[model samples]
Target: MYEQISHSLLNDILNRIKPDIYQKDLRHFYTRLGANFYAIHGLFAKLYGNREDFDLQAQRLVETMARQYIKREDELKQLDIERERDYNWFLNQKWVGMALYANGFADDLKDMQSHLSYFQELGVNMVHIMPIMECPEGQSDGGYAVSNFREIDNRVGSLEDLRSLSEEMRSRDMLLAMDVVLNHTSDEHEWAEKARTGDSTYLEYYYTFESRNIPDMFEQSMLEVFPETAPGNFTWDEKIQRWVMTVFNNYQWDLNYNNPAVFIEMLDVILYWANQGADILRLDAVAFLWKKLGSTCQNEHEAHLILQLLKDCCQVTAPGVLFIAEAIVAPSEVTKYFGEDAVIAKECEIAYNATFMALLWDAVATKNANLLNQGIKSLPNKLERATWLNYVRCHDDIGLGFDDKDIIQSGYEPQSHRRFLIDYLTGRFENSFARGLPFAENIKTGDSRISGSLASLVGLQYAIETGDVDAQENSVKLILLLHSMILSFGGIPLLYYGDEIGTLNDDTYLDDPDKMDDNRWVHRPNIDWGKAEKRHTPCTVEYDIFNGLKKMITIRKEINVFSDFNNRELVDVGNPNLFVFNRFNPQKFHDRVLVVTNFNDQPQKLDLEDVASWGTYKQGQLFDLHTRQKPEIFNNTLVIPSFSFYWLREM
Candidate 1:
């Protein structure tokens, strides 16, 4: 850390620091820079040492950090110091999160400011507001295609509104999470526009070429992200008459991270949001940050370097802020987003547990946890400092990205099982109550993902539509069962916006031309405050879900064992329908809670004899934490009801 070369570079950067930056009141900025200059210099050099203007660019990077730090509020600076003192504070079980779209969750950012009380009522301490950055109207991929990084989208609210909302959220001890589209920019973005005008310097910001000679090679190894819609990875810009690497869509051009200027610009954008009161910045499309020909253009070695560089830079500017890697790749690759380290998360502090979500859906459809268990077994252990953002549902399609070997180990054909899930959720399978739709269906590969709200995909929609009270009750239990797993799964459990109240799929997306093309919009519904009001009535469907989730959240917060200390142990109950796991304090193992779930429609018995060492057992004593009653165990067997879960502790 005290390398002479790095210190020398730091000294050089400090000497070149703008006089205007130092002339202003920048006590906190100078302190942070002094504390982190060594790491910053080292990472910057590693990333751009070969460039002729590396020193000049380094000066600009330092200036960007100083400018953003000066703009940050004094109270926020104090909050940052408090968070730094408690580095692992976010890993606590009490930090429940809810991810929502600003326009959909409320009317806009202003409306969201008023909903702070609602979040507090639900025991949510962190809220991830989906991308609100300025984007082209029709070209925006659900706000992923960012046209401007600094400006707020007018449809949501102004930058002032965001600051106000963030202030409100902070006052209530709730954290705000926002997105920064790191990998790509809208075709209408300034850089893209300049590239179109044949600006050679701007063209270097993206992967643009006059010939398809290199793009064709990359296509051979790269799989289509949107095979049915976007087709290939490259898109032709008629105005520029050049091929641009557009992995997601033609309107979204992938940023060239190999260029040092692009890297510095994105880092500035990241720090800008942190200064704007974003506690966590979810870096979008991180896996595709670096692209190399003859490879899949994802999970590349240089991609990790880019993230490492970015993380190091942020450590100097805003160490209190955390990064969420939005790389929904394979389980092995997903873990790497936390970075290759022994005890530290060099790349991101948090990463989405997309594999766990997909695996949970598999268990629901099959009425068993065989595949879930097998798939989880294959999941690599993450870095000690990093935690997962586990959730049952989010504003995205559920892609069955399970490992093929895990499917074989679970005694199922990989292709057929995936097909069965798609059919079951889409209502193509017999006796299936789910009314979901297929998304990104590739006819050649017969691969597709499912898209539907938590309630609709879980059969509550069909149950309510048919007026089947029993079916509805069972669906509600199923929803609670899934929530229980994420709650006790040794990580931060993230609830989607409307999942707590059983919001059904909105077919109205079919009426919107811009949204109808994307089936994922079916699940991304606007919150109905009127329907949400029914949560207070005990007998209402809204009441059942809302109160059930609220109770679960309260219970989860009370259990310290549920924190991310890697203290979970999977129990082999021998029954396929019974998924059992235990969470205990590593220091005091007896301070534990046993989580047992039944995926069956009938009563499933767990043999108490097999779990004697796993819990407190003297041949007969039983406890169910959720219901606050002794579970009936006859002849050393405990009965679990249909679609139910028990958070059992010692009686």
Candidate 2:
């Protein structure tokens, strides 16, 4: 790692390190800086070496880490040592996660502190507070267009409230996950504001150009993320008489990582959050970090180098703090976010399993597991140290970004199959009970994503509305079936805020002019405490889902085989209605659990002859872990009912 050119540059930067950096105890700083400087310098050079002020930028980078380290709490420093000792602690099976907006889940960060008991009741030990950073009230982009990296949004309470919440979570043995929007900044952000006011230095912080010539070249290969709503990738700034790259929205200006000053500033923002007691920092839009002409401007090679350098620098300052790469790209590229190393997760310790989420939804709409089995089999294996953030739903629209080969292998034409899924989930297909909406519809490509709450998409909304008891019960089964897969799937299962109690889509967003444009807001609703109270009332719909998920989480934490160790085996049962897999402890093969899911409306039998190698006390002895009861078995075969799943263990 110690290359002469990079080391010599690092040596020059270390020479400029303020005397104050050495005034305190920095033995650990010197050790880590020396260990990581090679990669850091290499990545920094690759990103911004051509700039005239490269030497000055490198000096500021060293100073930034030194200053942050000095301000870091002693208790946190001790935590870093403890985590360094137990490097594999994050890969544990017990770490079940739940993602929620601070305001949606509770009133604010302070109120969220009081709701710790609710999280504990659901057996959640990792909570991701989605984008609490300060942003323009109406142009927030769900808090992604951060106006200030150091401040928590006023709507979500103050920074003190966030710190208190993090402390409370830490005391409860839970991890606090926060977001740092690394790719873009709100135009209202101080730097962007100054750039708008004719500050050339501040303009360098973003991708700004005086003319459309270069923008036209970049737009040739860059895909518009919001083609229908936002239109183009570049937005003309009349004030500055220039064009700025606005990949997400016109108000959200993309930062230029090619500028070392931008890199150093973002690094400081990252360390600032780490000091705020965030155990895990989710890096947003990391795939689009480094942009290049004549390319899609995603998953760039320099992007990976930037992440590697960030990981290395974080290890020096806050070793306990982790990074979750929020890259929802193809299966072939998703694993690279975990890094290319055989053992070490050089880029990120965690990433969203968007593929698994999409594949699960495919199974739900089709009432079959043919695609789920085929898709997962094609999913690339993760690195030894990295883990997945598996979830049934999140605060975004669902894209059916499955590989074409996998679609064909599952006996469906790629384009037609995708169109069928969109139609089915949006209730355009016959007998489809889903009440979802279309998102990001592109007329040119005939492609679009779906947006709806988990309960609504699974027919619970339609069932309850029509007063059909049988359909309602089937909806509940479908909800639990989806949860079972994520729970036992090889990673930390992330539950969305309202999914546990079957919260329906909130159509109120259509009334709010600020939110009416985005359909994803339908699924991101405020928690109704009055309706949530019904979970304690037993016979209600809320009680069924709440209790079912509560029971499943409790059992999941107790199973060690559910850990993310690549110990899962996909079982081809030869029945399209059934999706099967096994989770076993390789060290002790006898400690195993067989997961079987029946997606059809009719009873589906699993032939015992095919899985005889699993060994069993016949079908009668098989018990469902979620329901805690023996299922019906006849002629050495087990029968799973309509829209149901079972985590069977021989008792």
How accurate locally, in lDDT, is each candidate?
A: 0.88, 0.90
Model 1 RMSD, rounded to 1 decimal: 1.6
- lDDT of model 2 at residue 3? 96
> Candidate 2: minimum summed lDDT over ten consecutive residues — where?
612-621
Per-residue accuracy of model 2 over 217-273 as CA lDDT, tens digit each: 999999889989999899999899999999999999999988888888999999999
lDDT of 2 at 333: 96
Q: What count of clashes does model 2 give? A: 0
> Which ten contiguous residues of candidate 1 have the minimum total lDDT?
613-622
Off by over 4 Å in 2: 1-12
